[model samples]
Each structure stands twice: as structure tokens, then as C-alpha cells.
Target chain A: MEATDRNNREGLKAWLNPSRYGAERISYWLQRLTGVGLLGYFIGHVYETSSLTQGPDAWAAMLELTQTPMGHMILLLVIGMSTFHSANGIRLIFTEGGKGLGKPGRPDYPYDAVSLNYRQKSGIWIALILAAAAMLFGASVLFGGE
Target chain B: MSETIEKLERLDKKRKEHEKKEIERSSIYLKIFRANRATGEQAHYDTVEVPVQRSTTVLDALLYAKGYKDHSIGIRYSCRMASCGSCGMKINGIPRLACYTKVSELYGDTITCEPLSNFPHIRDLATDFTQFFEHHKDMQPYIQNENADIKDPSKLSEFVQSPEDVDKFLQFSYCIKCGCCYSACPTVAMDTKFPGPQALAQAYRYFADSRDAATEERLELVDDRHGIFRCHFAGSCSTVCPKGVDPALGIQLLKGHMLGYSSNEKKIADLKERLMRK
Candidate 1:
């Protein structure tokens, strides 16, 4: 369907375009997307691991797939996503638990508060840094020895 | 009986003729959503144009359509200024006060107006605000004082506050309860359990007030799974606020307070209680 047609359908579709909003909204969409990705990976991992019950031969065949570059790349993707998700999740947990939010001051005209703003932006930065670091480590582990 | 029937038919024909002429004279077309609550009929758009003016607002256009074109159009507005906040509706997919939105400012000839999202639509442009106001009331949007003597005005002492203290919640106090913040909120759209921006912001307003004695109670009210935590700082609430009431900021500040990160110097002091005890 055309984008306009889909948008005209009704209900909330504004969140799909985070660029139209601010940084925090983008973070919200990314968090949800990463969460779903992790869930999918978990189910796949469980199925792959359960192959051990089928016998040694079946388990060996399953392990053979991981030898391919495609499998290595997939693993890297998972590692990156998980690292970002976990880091961001911790930030969310702290925020929801009401931690690290500095004192409330008297509101001035054009009333704004920067404490939460700074914390949220920093949280995103932390998650990105952790994700990048994890991907680098995974790349070395996958390709360095090879 | 035949003569009376002929007379009734003549009157009906004249009215249709008059309507055709009226439509021809109209310059601007108002495309409005129409619905009937009694029949449970499906809602549909009806367009009718009215004469335009330089100072014409969306509310004026809607009023013209209602008075001159279609009587079935439903809308709620009073105090045509932005103050009443009763005329909040989506004009071109953006939530705005109808009274505050000028028709001339809208691009193109046709203006598409719809009821605000994230609320139950009562009819054409009117949405049910019962739930909205209930959330506002739940947060105790008023100043709570335990020791103020209402019976005798002479016995009460003035509560002195510095300029800095007023600044803490001054902008948040400008909220007209328009529900624009509520409508623009993605969290409210996704999660029904969320307390919404308006309520959480007002909760902070009173919480920040030096005169209000219910700071602790207010904090506990919003410090919950469905309270301020649900807000991911979408910022739409602040962007769409016509009154410049930054509800997003209020929610964050409230979160900061709950986390023991408050920066406000003057705390809510119970002078009466202290004096009486002395």
C-alpha cells in the first residue's frame, strides 16, 4: 500500500516516524525494535540447542552450520543487538525506578529541566558505546583466529 | 387533504431551492466528520463552504458550517480564546485548539478537521473528556492545605513565596486541561494504564509548590508502574501544548524528585502547624 493510504487508515502511526519527533521518541522506537529482535533470537537459539536431544549426529550437523560466514555474521548481529538492548534496558530500569534524576528546581519561564534530558541522552550514548564495543569483540573472536 | 399535501410539497421545494443558492454563495468549504449517536450509524464526512474573513478561525468556519450548512455537525467550544481549551481537535493530523487555529493559516483550500485521537469520540468533532478530567482530578490538581482556616479569613496568614519558588511550577500551571498533551502522547495511545502527561505534570506542579503540603503524597501517587515511568519523553506533549505548558519537563522533574534529585531550595513548610505546636 502507498504510505499515505496506510497513514490515512486511522489510529496511532506517528511513532513509526521517529524523525518527526525528538531524540527520546527515537529511543523508544529503537528499544521496542531491539526487544522484538532479542525475543526472536531467543526462540531460534532454543530450537538450535534442543537439537542435542536428537543424538550426537544431529547435534554435529547443527554445529556445522555455525562454521559458515553467514552464521558468523548472524551471531555478530545478535551480539550487537543484545549488547545494545541490555545496556539500554539497564538505563530504562534506572529511569523507571526513579534513579539518577537530580533535584527538581523552581520552574523558570520557557520552563525547562535538563537533568532528565542529560541522563536520557547519556543513557543512549552508553548503549551505543557498549553495542559497538561488543560487536568489535565478537568480530575478533569470529574472524581473528580464522 | 389533497390541497394540504400540495402546500407541504411546495414548501419543501422552496427550501431546497434556497439551499442551492446558499451553497453557491459560500466561498470556503468545511469538510466535517458527521455521526449520529441515536441511530448507531456510521460516521461520514460532509463538506459545506462559508464566506471567509481575515480573522476567521477554524472554530468560526465550523460554526458557520453548523449554523448555515449542516445542523447535524457536533462541536464543543466556549470562550473562543485559547483559554477555555474546549475546542481542541485535530486539524490536518495535528492536535490544536480550533479557536486558536486560524483557517487562513492552513494551507490549501480544504481543511480536514477530525476529533482528537486517544479519546472516545462522542460525535463529529466532540470527544468524551470524562476520562481525561477524571485523571486530572485523581492527581489532586488543586493546592492541598491541612491547616488553613476557611471559617475565619482574619485568622489566616499570608503564604510568602520568593520569585524563584514560583518559577519551579509556573509554566506547568498554564495548562488549560485541553487534552492536546493527552492526544499527542504515544504512551497514552499504546497503554491505557498510563496516567498521561497532563495528570503527571499537574502532580509535579502541586508537588513543586511551596504552599502545598501534600508533596510526599503527590510523589507517591505518580511514582508507580503506570505513572511517570510510562512516559518515554516523546516530547510531542510539549510540542503541541498551546499554552507552552511543558508537561514532558514536569514528568521528568517529578521523576528526578522521586529519585531524590530535587534542586528546589524552598521546601513546603507548615508554619501554622509549627506555630500551633509551639
Candidate 2:
């Protein structure tokens, strides 16, 4: 009744859920989440950088806040999120431009989608793997005590 | 499946009777969402138990509930088979054709039947498909041939095409317009103006047909921001398709043609004044 315009639209709840849908939906969920996370980080990074214009102490204070163990963990999370976003984003770019998804054909009985071919589904897996690898490597470097 | 309870059944006569009752639970509980969406009445789940046979479908179960339990329980169905595509609803949290889904095929004891999401609920289990059909209509879901002359009823001319060409768009052509794919789509759940998987797939169906000539024009229709590009390839549309019409594949291939990846450049040609002169 409240939604007379759209009528029971699932909205963000459906968009955030990657469980029921296939690999692409998982990617969809990851992409949107990471995009938002990255946007927040970008704004914070800009503010962090702009602290240098205030004074040397402000810059040092900003560094002290961000260069700690907790900050490193947050950075690690950001790294993982960004890696997933970009990796999945690349896959999406190719997919949206129609590269990896296979050609349409006569769907056989007990049908499996040719559209969700090995290449397309694997893209989500590859993005996740890439994100994991980046996070692990970033963890080693960030927390290596250099 | 009965063997799992056989061990306990042999323990005692009481246990055997209990096991028999367990095995022969003839009626299943259907937790159906009841609401007159037009009237905006209170929405609630009406759990109704209907006797089911081996071959009884979800549609049959609903019909029984409507007939015996409550005549006011509203439902829309036609052609008790899956072809008509009318009796599509969310059965056990998945969008499916009720006639196509047997009650035995459902997993749990209480099968949840609700009107399909992302559609305006008409009554209890029926949803209005006006928007969905409008999107289908917007796609111009028909062959647009520039070279055809219906001069004589006796003399018929067919557009020459190979079987290989038919294979390109044949799967997408199987769409019954049940709205199962549309309801399952995450993009459709979010964006209303998006042509949805069905229309987009049908757009590709006609686009890929060898007999159809309007390629650039069709591509132009779906190349907008809210068109094919809005689809993030969630693949749920393909997952829930009742007739195996892979709308995701069709939409992607449609995107390929839209972005010049597949290189479709067909256009309308000028009609000849006379067939004999040409």
C-alpha cells in the first residue's frame, strides 16, 4: 500500500543477497558493497591528505591515527574490498560488453544456461581468489613490522 | 526414503503406527499469503492443509483449498500445464510455475505460497502482469521484415534461412511470459523501467532471427542507461525460467549486438514497386 508506485519491490535487500542467485549475483553483491566502501575510503583519504595543508602536526596526527594496528586492519579490509571490486569490475566490463558470456543457442531440456558458461562463472571465483591473494599479501606487508 | 524410519518402526507396534502415519501424511500444509492487493487489505499467511496425491501439483493443492476450504481465496490459472504461464508464484521461496511444480517436488512440510514479488499483487496468489507485458510490448517482440509482399494468397513466399540461424534465437523464443524470470531478477527487483530479462531476451530473440531485418533500430531501443546495461548478469532469471528460456544469455547476447561486439548491422531496405520487375 505504501509502495503504490513499485509494489513490493525487494529494493536493497534483494540486491545485497548473493545466496539464492548464481555467481553473478555474488559478484553483484560484492561489487556494490565494495564500491560503497571504496567511496567512503576515498573521501576519508582526501580528508587525510588535506590535513597536510593545515600544519605539520596535523599531518603527523593523521599519520599516527592511520598507521596503527587497528588502522592497518581497516586498510587490509579496504584492500580486500577494492581488489574484489576492481577484479569483478573488469569481469563485468567484459561481460557487459559481451565477451565472456557464451552465445545463445537452443536450450536443451533440463536446461543449463549457456550464458552462465565456465568463463563467466569463473570470473567471480577469480575475483574472489584475487581479492584473497591481495589481502594476504597486503597483510604480510602492512603488518610485517617494517 | 522410507528406510530411514524402518529401524524405529520395528521396535514396537506403536512406533510402527507412528512411522506409518509419518509415511502416509496424505495432506500437506500450504502457508499461503492472503491479501486483496487492490483493496489493500491486511496481508497474512493462511496455512491450509489440502490432500495431495502422487501426481497432484501445487496448482491442484491451491485449487482444492479454494474449492473446499475458502471460496474467497483468489488464484488465477489456465491450461493446467506450464505452457500458459498464468499460475506463476513464489512456491517455497522460489518463483515457479504452480502447474509445473508438483507438491511432491517441494522440500518442506509447509510449502509457502505467495504472490510473486516485484509485481502488483492482484488478489491472494495472483499478481498483475501489466507492467511486464508493457515492457514486452516496448521491445516490439515481433519480426520486422522489410522484404515481404502478400500479393496473392495462392502464391506464398517464405524467408529463406538455415537451421543454424534458428538455433541462435530459438531458446529465447520459448518464453511463455509467465513473469517467473522477471520476479527472480535482482535488477528487476530494483529498477522498474529496465526492460527486464524477458523483454530484453525477447529483444535478442527477434534481433537474432535471420528473417528479421531491423537490427540497429532494435539495438537503439535497449542501448539506453536503464536498458541492457543496467543488468549486472545476476543469472537468477535463467535459474528460475520455467520453460528453459535462458533470459540472461539472451540479454548478454543482446548486449553484445548492442555494443557492436557481435557485429550485427542489419537495416531496412526499400521495397521494390513490383515483384516481377525486380
Candidate 3:
């Protein structure tokens, strides 16, 4: 009974957390957040690539800066979010483009017409796998896991 | 004095003869939903027994109840025909002109009368129209075409329109602004951003007009989330529209135009979706 009570208390705490509403709100915010994340990453990538214009020394300095523990972690986080956002966007593009996410046969129907189905589920699974792989690769280079 | 007495006797005889021939009518209970906004109290219904004859309209019943039974019942009525656009209310869960709805057609002893939906209630069966009419005013619902300066009929000439071109917008042009469709719209109930069915229908009326210079500009107004996309096409607005203007069709047509699809192609897509879902 005590153990059961402890489990119930933890459940209650989880429900009461501020992030409870945050999770539910994510689906609607997913597109906007992903757009912002991708734009930021693209800008940063362009700046880093521009270093090659200066000399090899500038390029090496930028690379070494990204090799630090905190820098490496930030890069991994950005890549992970970008992959998730991109996959979800692809799922939406199919939906908005009238490819069936809900109804299987009628691929050209509007997003609202077909109820969301396994195609979207597949998109989500694929995104998660790609993000995990990126994270693993990112950690390996930084931590000597390679 | 003798002439007045003789006249009174003749009128009495006529009254007696008319009573003998007069058909006995039934009395009905009108259940009206009343809300007091001053107190910030919610709506509640009160049933009033009204004496109604076969020829009596719903407006007649309301007037009878107000004049004889209770004077506090609030109602706005003028030009009792459907032309005036006043006396609009929800009769039996549908927005209808009280002057036009016959009392004999209503089933059950109790007929529910309430204000039009999607507006703030002022009193029993009366709604605040400031918001409803403001939507139309925002659109600048007048012709802004090149021909606005052409006053002379002979100089201007009629805009050459075939029967088909005229028919597309003819149905939408008959809006009385009675707000029957606006009240009955479920989408309007959910979101205020959605420029309700009436406004969208009006927008399309001008957008389809050949002479209207601001078609593209008007389309931009209704192209956003709060504009045409909010309509789920429940078809209730079309059902309740007194003038037979199908705002549902207008909204669907507007949506098709906004989505970059031909009307016929979108219709086929809708049909295909329906079949696939089943």
C-alpha cells in the first residue's frame, strides 16, 4: 500500500508539472519552432563556411571552437531538433499537398479529409531514428567513442 | 341617441354572427429563452401560454403575449413581412423571421424562441448586433470598380454578363443582413477570427463580380486563418438562410479558389474523400 501510494504521488507530481501543457501544445507549435531552428542553423552554417574565405587558419579556429565539450553538446542538440522538425514538416507537406496521411487510398485528398494514419506514424519513427543516429555520431567524435 | 343605439345593436348582431362562424383555435405555449445582461446572469427560459388561431403567425403570438400577458418580454419587430429583415430569431433551433414563420406549422405545444446564435444576447430573443454589422462595415461593402465614375447609364452601358456569370453571384447578393446565417454557423461560434459565413459570402459576392476592381484585395482579407479556412462546412448556415443564399457553397467555393484548385476539381476531390472514408 505504501509503495502504491508513492507511485500515485509521483503520478500526481508529473500531472501538476508546468511541462504538462507544454507537451500538448507542441504539435501546434511544431512547425513554427522547427522553422526558427532550421533558419538559425542555416545562418550559423553559412558563417562557419565563410571562414574558408579568410584562410585555413580561420577555418581551423572555428572547427576547434566547435570541438569543445559544451560547443559539441549544443551542435548535437541543434542537429537533433532540426532532424525532428524536418521530418514532421515532410509529414505535414504530404498532408497539405493532399497525400493521404489519414485515408490510405485517396492520396490527393485535403489534409483534413483523411484522418491521420500510419504514414505520419512512419514519418515520426523515421525522424526519431535519424535524430538518434545523428546524436550518436555527434557524441562519438566529441567523446572519442569512435 | 337612438341612432347610436341602433348602430350598437347592429354591431352586436354582426359580432354574434361572426362568433357563430369563427373557427375555434388552439392556444400554444411559447418557451422563450431570456437573458438579463445587466445582472451578468445566464440565460433561462420562460413558457408563456399564447392564444393562437390558425392564421396567427409566431410574431402575432409574441405580440399577444407581450400586450396582454407580460409587457417585459423584449422583441424588435417592424414591417411584419420577410422584407423588413427585422424579427429574426431562432424558432425550433433554427434562425427564422418570426413574421414569416406560421404558428400552425410548429409541432408540439411548446415552441422555443431564442436570439440568433454567434452574437451577444441583450434580452429575451434580442441580440447585440454591433459586432454582427461591424464585420460588413469592415469590408467596405460597396462597388469600387472603374465604372464608379460612369454615372450616365447610356455612357456606362450595362456590364455584359451572360446568364451563367450573373447566376454565380446572384444568390449571394440577396443577403438582408438579418444575420440568420451568422447565428446558425457553428464555425463562427468557435472562432471570432473567422469572418463568419455572412461576411465570407458577401466577400465572394464582390470577388466574383467582373466589375469589382478589388477582387484580389478582398481575397487577401479572407485568405488567412481567421478568414475562409475556419469554415468546417457544417451546412447549418445554408439550412437556416431565409433567402436561400447557400453560404456553405460560397465558403467552399472561396476555399477552393484560395487553395489553387478549380471548383470542379475540388468537388471531385471532396467526393473522392467521402467515398474513401466510408
Question: C-alpha displacement of B245 in model 3, angstroms?
Answer: 0.6
**Candidate 2, B50-137: lDDT as tens digits:** 9998678899999999999989988889999888999999998789999988777666788999898899777788788988999999
Give the per-residue Cα lDDT of candidate 1 at B222: 81
Candidate 1, residues B1-278: lDDT per residue as tens digits?
A: 99769966876776566444431222567777776544565778888877877668889989988887788788999999989999999887778999987776676678888888787777778887877888899899887776556677766767888887788778788889998888888888877667899999899889888888787788788878887777876667876778777687778767766776654433524555577789
Preferred candidate (DockQ higher): 1 or 3: 1
Query: Could you give the TM-score of chain B for each candidate, in order?
Result: 0.83, 0.84, 0.79
Candidate 3 versus the native: TM-score?
A: 0.55
After aligning candidate 3 to the native by TM-score, how far in Å is the CA of A95 from where it should be? 17
Candidate 1 segments whose C-alpha is farther than 4 A from its true place: A1-23, A53-56, A64-80, A83-146, B1-30, B48-56, B103-109, B152-155, B263-278
- Model 1 lDDT at residue B110: 81
Give the worst 10-residue stretch by lDDT in candidate 2 chain A: A1-10
- Considering just the first chain, candidate 3 attains a TM-score of 0.60
Q: Cα RMSDs of all predictions?
A: 14.8, 8.3, 20.4
Please identify which of the two predictions, 1 or 3, would achieve the higher TM-score against the true structure.
Answer: 1
TM-score leader: 2
Tens digits of lDDT, candidate 3, B161-275: 6666666677778778888877766556656656788888888777666556676788788878677776644445655666666665666666656676434432454489799
Stretches of model 2 off by over 4 angstroms after superposition: A1-6, B1-25, B149-156, B265-278
- When 2 and 3 are scored with lDDT, the better candidate is 2
lDDT of 1 by residue, A1-146 (tens): 22222111224575665654466667777777788888998998899999999999999999999878999998998898889888988887666544654444433333334333678788988898899999999999999884
Ten residues in sequence with the least summed lDDT for candidate 2 chain B: B265-274
Q: Candidate 3 DockQ score? A: 0.01
